[model samples]
Target: MEASEPLSGTCHCGSVAFEVSRPAFMVACNCSICRRYAALWVHAPPASARIVEGEGQTDTYIWGDEQIEFHSCKSCRAVTHWTGVDGARWAVNMRMVDPADLEGLPVRHFDGADSWEFLD
Candidate 1:
């Protein structure tokens, strides 16, 4: 769970697996979709994350402007991560990450619904 340690996570059914460098912090967004899912997000470069398994066992959902595509595990229906349509940016669902790996990391609130800005 140290900052230097890498992070690996999977969906409830293990149909989706991925890894990211330990995040220094994460965001809790209040947008409608995020609020519904209650997802905590950890940002990472698209290249920094790799799908270790279940590439074909996942489903994508893109709505609104469709700038980002949310990915979930088809088997367990767990929201695992999302990526920009352009493949430029990405975010992992912190809920799927190990609790031990999130210790000491700040969770900032984001006003994604009204202002699309960080609240603190």
Candidate 2:
């Protein structure tokens, strides 16, 4: 929310591109895959997430109840966060963001894997 600034992030191929209008509230989900992936996520409405390109290159991995559709590059296997079940929002990857644009952002960890709501 820093002054309502925006930042840009892209995949290694530069095929997929995205922009963030402001610094996002980062979340560190302690779910098994999340901890292993070690991604800092920025939750935003799906409209805020624009796939400038690389639509076909995106791969999906469904697990558990198949809620979050984890998207990653098919070539490099670089994860780009996830789109919600009905595509309501996007939880974008933090590492994709430029360091300078993300100054003073706070990150929180959630026990998503153990939570009854998230876990079966």
Best by lDDT: 1
**Estimated TM-score per prediction?**
0.92, 0.82
Candidate 2 regions with alpha-carbon error over 4 angstroms: 116-120
Clashing pairs in 1: none
Cα lDDT tens digits, model 2, 1-120, are 456556677777776667765644677888888887788877786225566667778888877788888888887787876887876777778777777777887776677887624221
Among the numbered candidates, top TM-score falls to 1
Clashes of each: 0, 0
lDDT of 1 at 54: 81
lDDT of 1 by residue, 21-114 (tens): 7766788999989999899888876226677888778799998899998999998999999888998888988898878777787889999999
Superposed on all Cα atoms, the candidates' RMSDs to the truth, in angstroms, are 1.6, 3.7
